[model samples]
Target: MSAAPVIVIGSGLAGLMTALTLAPMPVVLVTAGRLGQAGSSPLAQGGVAAAIGVDDDTSLHLADTLAAGDGLCDAASAREIVGRGRDAIMALESHGVRFDRKPDGSYALGLEAAHSRHRIVHVDGDATGAGIVKALVAKVRETASITILEDCRALRLIKRDDRVVGVCLEGKGPVAARAVVLATGGAGGLYEATTTPLGNLGQGAALAGRVGARLADMEFVQFHPTALAVSAPRLPLISEAVRGEGAILINDRGERFMADQPGQELAPRDVVARAIAAEIDAGRKVYLDARAALGEGFVRRFPGIFALCQEHGIDPARMPIPVRPATHYHMGGIAADCDGRTNVPGLWAVGEAACTGLHGANRLASNSLLEAAVMGLNAGRAIASEMTAATVRLEPVSLPQMSDPAPVRAIVSRGLGILRHETGLRAAICALLPKAGHDDAAAVALAMAVAAFARCESRGSHARTDYPHKNASGTRKLFTMDEAFAFARELAASQPLSRTA
Candidate 1:
């Protein structure tokens, strides 16, 4: 393949938007799965978080994000993202995305948890991600300067000294470029049950770390409060918007348990999910009943969720929907600035793969897509500007072969799911490290292990029973590859011989 001006890993919303923003510049978009299938963007139900309504302001949006994040959100990053939300939403609209509107031509807004006002702009009720991805993919196809390469997974980033040269793909050797953008989504698929696509396995974070990119807040993973508890191997999401539209959580005894919690069904995701999990742990079946609250309008509005419920033989219009906590989004990734530039020169990251400090501890509902668009745009522009000032050269690098991911997946799911203790996490790290040794899957597992070990306190999405108290330090934790390697080695040394590889 010919060397391009920029190489963007993953073809979801963020990667596509990053390429689109650099219009007229030669760009290559790579994906592990087919375009629009690997990331959670296509599975998003609630709309993007934007201050499109007259009642909504950037300040209000920022306040909601900070409150939902439980005091860990960076005020400046929150303000910047919320301030730019309208323009990003308008840009998506300009690209032929059809957002739902009121009868009087105003944008129809939906309310979600921790938000004081209606600010979410969705499409087709549910399936906002689908609508956004469709528009983005269409724009990408029409752009002559952009090339889409499907079934190509980025293995590792190539770095010479402190600068990233290019990335090595699985089947297609090293495709070099002046700049590289890692938008390879999250690690939800690392869990046994998750709403994320099967390939959302933290490859970008791993790739960046292997190249010595600084990673931040890797321990904080958001669990959606209400994923449908189906018999399928992987769990499916039941959108938070459903609760916003008035769904009530009930136990097998027909008790509305959420009434005992703060904000009831409208509580922040971590709070609500824990409550549901507690109910299940207490041997009560949990159900989300929206029949009385939403009525037939539920079927008309959220047709995607409605159909999913029908396929499971549970009609939201008739009875309650069974729900459980499912792995949703990762709040940590390769640490980057607002412009998406990593510590390594010629390397940048955006979307779910980059920890831009926008979603500090926990992300507000639907804010991810907005962050992806805004940051992707900024990254693309910044990379283009940087390339203009220097000569471009393509450097080739070799990638190591990977082993089966089944073992690592099982280890993460059993030891690192919603609730974690020190023993389980340590054991998990020991079991996984050997299997992941020097391979792509191992690199990804190492990042997750390092992050999980660093954060001991129970806060937001990452709850530890051993360290139940929230730490007063409150400083953001960042890790480099060397630091992570040292920590992993130390842990391995402390463990028994059987645990070590």
Candidate 2:
């Protein structure tokens, strides 16, 4: 008989690209929701960054990525991934992704934060993610070797003899597989004010950690500086592309507070987010003024954003849009290599779920998509090359209860916001330790809290009030679930509050 099919979790850009790249190889694609309706991929507004411009090159892109990483990025991984930009774009285009172009038939590139050149390749202005996913979804449906299972959530990974062999799906029994690839998105959904899909509550990290996978850089959660400041369950993002189009950030007093700051509106996301957060903390409401810059062209350039504003009874062309920092991305995840191979045998991770070290402590704008596509494709190829025909009967294992993030969301959001401190991190750790065993979200949150507390200095997206400066030497943390829980337990025991309460 043929070997069991490879099981891929999640249906975002990473998962989709992986399955697509593994064509003619039997694969099972799983997702918690409808194929194209789930995850943070479709909600992405910024385009993929590529060094295909006349004045651009891989070295230049790598330099920008490293600069944004704040001395924490793995230089080797950054260079390799940035160098694959043109290839990744071509691969996506071959899979039916048609990027926006100018009348001259050249790619229409847009500028964003931190990049020295206009390297963001978009589609229909702000709908780049949606467009790419739509085309890839259509392609996946036509592929003969891929079997898609929608609305199937992965609860935990099944490991045998120190190797992950399969995954237990929620509401369904174990699905035996030769290998498992996790493409689940990041932990932004753990935040109260976030732009990530509500269902993306760090399940990827939880699943890997439970199965003994090493996770890295868990403290660096990138907050977008300009989410629409409105009452909503999930905040709407005001993409950095708007600022690239010449929008300026102003306060209630109509002061351009970022005017004197280096790079101003175009600084790295962490810098921009902190600036906006500082303004808000000072009791001044912040707004993104696009009137003079885009004016009537606002709707034409960012139709999706324009409509979202209109729905909230605001117009970008005429008035300044209220904005605030919101959790947008997670730079930390399972410590996977360039080919998405985790330390665990037979298991791989890609996209936002895997820490390939390309983004470092913070991600360069638009580079997430580039990394996702490149790594996803690379993972698929690597997995295909390592395919084995050995068939083994899987034993039945008891399935655990489904993971719920509801209880942990408030705890995490309070402590791990744009700004963090020792007190808040410890409190979060204490509250989450007990729940880590049975609750996946709590497990992930507990690990993150520990990482945040251990890092004594502020760097990139992780800012600590007590430790307000960067350390001379920055370190990337790598820990398993056991290590995280042990650290939390030790820390909690030493604290006065834990002893009393």
Candidate 3:
């Protein structure tokens, strides 16, 4: 709390880009884990999606994005992000990010699933996330206006008369600021096995709901169809680039299953993931075979995935790598405009935390980094453009204390996981409410429960067998805190009580 003009939560690509874009404006970056430990950005294998190739255009890129989003993408937002993709990539280059280049000295673009062209730009092949993060972190360190506070978790947002003024931290004290940008990433940790950092437990989305911000499409949790199937606590991801390079999805029977699908091995992630889930349920193991497709080039091109696969006793060049669907990204989050403005004034969200209508129902491959860079800069510019020197004094909002996290974790993992049903969801809501009592953890659980209950239809990542049909209209829904609470109460009243405090 050094009287900075802006307080940014999380230090991923979005947070770091936002802070850096607001150069010379005193800003403080607070991270839950070490700056780079809590985000999925650094774990990204495929690169950012941009219209950099001579044959590629924004319209084509937009079409690819909309197609991957399953007809729910906001056309305007998709066009805007796609149009700016090239510029965003160039901006990163200006910030000293070294991308991979071909022998001809131009960017070596790679293809990914659901994209019609070679638009994914990487660095060191599969280490795009690490490379981009490394550059941004270096830039942030040299900037005098940006102060880095590591291992500081945001407990709750501080509000006064519907305007966010600051946030309460777990370890560090409260940070008062003129503007707050949430870039805490996605809710992958809510699942038992996920590719995202273990600390990304949807706190940002929950905090926004508590502060009365509108949340959109919370049901669209995107599960990566090919995370390395291992017993590790945090499952590692085998990049989609492997498939992009011609790897085939096979079952334990040595059958190539993806060939039966529309896009084959390059289908939208949801389709691929659901197919894999079905195969697994049928007692067949899914594998990503890249031996014939990549040969020795696999090791050189994707050293990160190669090393990880090697550590797990699966040689990418020799054997078919075991894979499974794991919670990877959340397509829904706090509803924000293109500039990252939330319903609450002075509160902005970007990257995975903000639903900018870019991803729609499902996110396209490698488009995440592009969104982070573009939206981060947009949010940064928006905050800087509306700078105010008037310091508004505000009373602190009291948060209820919590002692245990086990019960909350269990509730989230069981009820609101990869698969959902009305019975379990209702039971989860009933069990979580009393245990939450009046604590902040309970407040978060309540939001999740409410969101899970509202999305009755099986769409995107939220698969509800009870409500199996996909909503035909594909209309995106946004919920305010009051709406969520009311729905939760209604659902709670209808269900029989299983537990009472």
Tens digits of per-residue lDDT, candidate 3, 430-486, equal 877665445545555566667767777776666788988877764888887667667
Ranking by lDDT: 2, 3, 1
lDDT of 1 at 51: 85
**Number of clashing residue pairs, candidate 2:** 0
Clashing pairs in 1: 436-442
Which is superior by TM-score, 1 or 3?
A: 1
Q: List TM-scores for all candidates, in order.
A: 0.96, 0.98, 0.95
For residues 255-296, what per-residue lDDT tens digits would candidate 1 score against the true structure? Answer: 999897778998888889888889988888999999998878
Query: lDDT per residue, candidate 2, 177-222, as tens digits?
Result: 8889999999988888898888888889999998899999999999
lDDT of 1: 0.83
Q: Give the CA lDDT, 0 to 100, for residue 177 in model 1.
A: 72
lDDT of each: 0.83, 0.91, 0.84
**Candidate 2: 10-residue stretch with minimal lDDT:** 492-501
- Tell me which residue pairs clash in candidate 3: none
